[model samples]
Target chain A: MDKQYSEDSRQFVPETMSNMRFAVLVLGHGEMGRSMEHLLSGRHALTFWERNLEDGSENIPLEQAAAQKDFVIFALPALPHAELAERIQAHISDHCICLSIAKGMDEQGRTPAAVLGGVLGPAGRFGMIYGPMIAEEVRAGHPGFAELGTTQSDVYERTRELFAGAPLYLRHNTDVIGVSWAVILKNVYVPLLGAAEEAGLGDNARGFLATAALEEMARIIESRGGRRETAYSLAGLGDLVTTATSTGSHHRQVGRDLVHCAPGDTCGTGMNVHSEGIHSLNMVQRFGLLDLESFPLLRLVRDIVNEPRDVAAKFRPFLDASFADAASRNTRD
Target chain B: MDKQYSEDSRQFVPETMSNMRFAVLVLGHGEMGRSMEHLLSGRHALTFWERNLEDGSENIPLEQAAAQKDFVIFALPALPHAELAERIQAHISDHCICLSIAKGMDEQGRTPAAVLGGVLGPAGRFGMIYGPMIAEEVRAGHPGFAELGTTQSDVYERTRELFAGAPLYLRHNTDVIGVSWAVILKNVYVPLLGAAEEAGLGDNARGFLATAALEEMARIIESRGGRRETAYSLAGLGDLVTTATSTGSHHRQVGRDLVHCAPGDTCGTGMNVHSEGIHSLNMVQRFGLLDLESFPLLRLVRDIVNEPRDVAAKFRPFLDASFADAASRNTRD
Candidate 1:
């Protein structure tokens, strides 16, 4: 290398790392995954293991594509986040930085971070990008943005710098657990907010629901060992607001799922997504794990999800719960 | 007064102000304003003032509305709040408590709490109900809630306990400024998320935007003496989430404002409604007063709001931006 070139090279991490390629294995490729491929494509050598590929190679082993790459990203649903971590842990180099972008709580009503952390050990650099950057916007190269978070502030900066070259807008932070909690917990409420819209409630109703959801989620996350403000930041409050208001959020879709059925349908006509809140809500309620101030939204969400089908009529009363009594529920002793 | 009742009330308050007949007057009958009324209704000798009440005549004069309503609640837009305060000072009783439920940065982008505190004298009981209760839900007997704060914690508790009745929840804290700032600033970005959704973005995009808005709003609120954790709590986090996701949210309506040509036009041709973000976004771009992490969604909203009618094709490019490196606008630092 020339002297000036050598000096510059020493300063900048080369786009193409010699002997260390990146295997961008996107498990879901639903919407964000394909776009993740697009953003991560030029960073290093790229190969992917999309569960739902364009053709029908959903089951293709990661070895075929991820065999030589140094970095692997799990851009799938929470369902496979832990399992993927286990499989990836077997072959991934300790030096490799692994990132996950899924936003659902896991089977134990824990954030994907909790489970992912358990599976991946405490040493690997785990990074995540979350916020309002939709997959399509990212794929389209319109400066859609997200916050990059990780335990390793240096790694968070590194990952942010790595993906910063892409067309998408990336905000940097060092709160991977916060980001994980935000993405995971927000999943539960998004559907509920979406349903509220489909239920024909006005902005006031939607606003109230989303706000309460944040309160409840924050409380729950805090109880579960997450920072309260972390949830309040871009990860928690910001993401939830974006999702609840978005045109077609999965939670909104879930609300729609509950709406199309008869009023007697308990679980919104069973058309709802199988969300973590569906389980978390029930667990919280069953365990009476929280005070009245926390998790009211979660209780409602659980009631709507786990009950057989008559959730519509039960929830309808809430909508009609009398304007005179809809006083503010501030939750103080 | 019944001795037992007074004694019962004393349990919730300090001995100094237990006997004071708190005349709480609520200005504005919109969702938040009216929600205040709902909470304050049976609890105190509350009077309400709706700004555009074309027909109602049970209304009192502005002097009377401001006359000694122990708590003077300004539940209107940002522009009108300060004006209301100016007019309120004359009719204000010797020790009136001025509270606000409005969630907007003032003309100077100040939180309602600070402006109220500054205007009401340094010792005024100027606090606010900052939370995510939908006005409809609040009025409808659904659980609409908020947090109350004051430089005077005793005054905070006085207001807190006054409305601590059934169905009306109140969270108590001393972060009056933080809660107020969070409430107003979050509204700036809710609609921006709506536009992104209408533009056909996905969960990642919306999540990113929502989270970013929270972070920005929290910072703005914190800069003005509000707590970021409070923003994540019921008032800040809960309210924002509810507002953004609520189908009837003004913030969410920002999307419809831009997406539909007419208010009722659902064909996705053009939008109606002037989202606060469109206004705030322009302010952000024009003033550069915000950090790089401020509301991008708001910026997009402002862009569309200012766009000429003939450039519909240009707006449609959001969908294709990511695909074409069009989303990359920020200079890499």
Candidate 2:
């Protein structure tokens, strides 16, 4: 641990690597993207690779990003996740480990790491950075932390060393699959909690949701071939708690909006972020169609969130259904 | 589907065989055990195996519970989970199916199903029921859904059928190991949420906690031989949401009290109704032994809830710590 680590340094410049200049190619410059810049500010040598709004450049041209950096972080949205990876595929260097901040599954439901695996080939070294560390917190020097997952143990160690002097706590995991899925699917649970709270549910409701939500996340991550416990670690559940509990959560905004809206008002795009939850809830239902276990609450959330309704009323029918005979089914075993 | 299944008449009993009326013997009259009765009443021939306060005689001793009934549900605490199964094993009939309503892992950190399978030899079929449906819900005619997991799909179906017309939504799964773990371990997430809520977090905070909690649950269940996607199902996330969201949730009650008092202070005695969550959380820590994936927040809960002030201070650092770091972990390759 560096003596400087305890001190408030917006960016920690590794004295050991002062001569080593690395381009901090940030794919997306949302609050998270900006936070990454702040974390990497004086820590390493960095060059810019953002699709500058003023410059009116198309999404940060991969060719330019490739030439400028020693490392790359793909911090884009889920929809643009694959496209960005595909664009940056050839540009990622063999030695330069790629880090993904975008927490979502691709169109194929593959995580950012999986997409990168396809883009970077068999030997691709990938590192996943996830947690509740928002850009605003990082900028404010409010000591925060994150989880880093990598197939190679050394990659984690190196990333730890790189950020050794920073305030964020970095943890390790072998199951990037679990961590990635957690980072993505966890978003779905958040909206529901928000809706529950908006609907006047109490602390007990939050507690139950917390446990139930993790159960659901474990199933999703495991389906994607990640370690189940990884979701419980800082990477998955821990980070989600921080984000979902904070003021800046996009899901919270959506939930507040859901407070007044009627069912089926999902078409409006006025919310701060794309309701990735809508997609995940659909994915959960798709699982049901595939003869998978029924995630009824998830279906309820998707339905209620997209189609604004009597939140409590819409949510209650299922909750009110019979415990014995109310269990639904039409699936062929 | 018997036509008589929907009626109040006793004349038309199904003639799959002679009138061999089998009872759904509940071997533990705690919340889950009692809850099972409400769901099974008017549907299955019901009886309970708990110590009758009036005469102090259980209908059938735990030792004889397995052999006498067609279906036996063991809804005991984790401490005696293995012992209950062992007792059931001693009394189990050759063709009886043993189901556990206990949603927690055994002493070896194995699912109750796996533990039961080993203890019961080849004489009995072991299965698990997991989800958010509480005994109160079943008693109130509310939908009480749960996942019944077993090795054979037929067992799942049969168990689901046994709960027929009882106002319970039943789901069947092949991952008994996963289902049991998901159901049991989720209890750990509750107090953690309660603690966070106690600490004065808002909707976003709850949202973050919910997602992270489920992610953590998924990882924990998967590590213990359960499926990941199961976490996404009703057994996993759905149950967590319900438990975390309601005052009806016994676990959160402990948490709410813990913020100001002790668990014993709130629930007069384990006698009125069972608080499986209290025991489940303890069992989780005992069985998990440092299995960070299962209950990272539980340690804090136990300390804050059970420990002295100064000792609890160590746990406090984490409360203020960035959840991103707390949820994520050891990212070394």
Q: Against the true structure, whose DockQ is highest? A: 1
Q: After TM-score superposition, what is the CA distance of residue A306 in candidate 1 from its true location, in Å? A: 3.3
lDDT of 1 by residue, B65-177 (tens): 77857777787766577777887887787767777766655566555666776777776667777776666655555555566666565666566556655344455666776
Q: Where is the poorest 10-residue window by lDDT in model 1 chain A?
A: A8-17
> Which parts of model 1 have CA positions greater than 4 angstroms off?
A1-65, A75-97, A102-149, A152-176, A194-202, A219-226, A233-235, A255-273, A276-300, A308-333, B1-126, B130-144, B152-170, B187-204, B233-235, B238-333
Model 2: per-residue Cα lDDT over B35-54, one tens digit each? 77656666568778776768
Q: Please give the lDDT score at residue B188 for candidate 2.
A: 66
Put down candidate 1 lDDT per residue, A208-257, tens digits, no spaces.
56655665566666786667666665566656665565554555566667
**Candidate 1 lDDT for residue B146:** 62
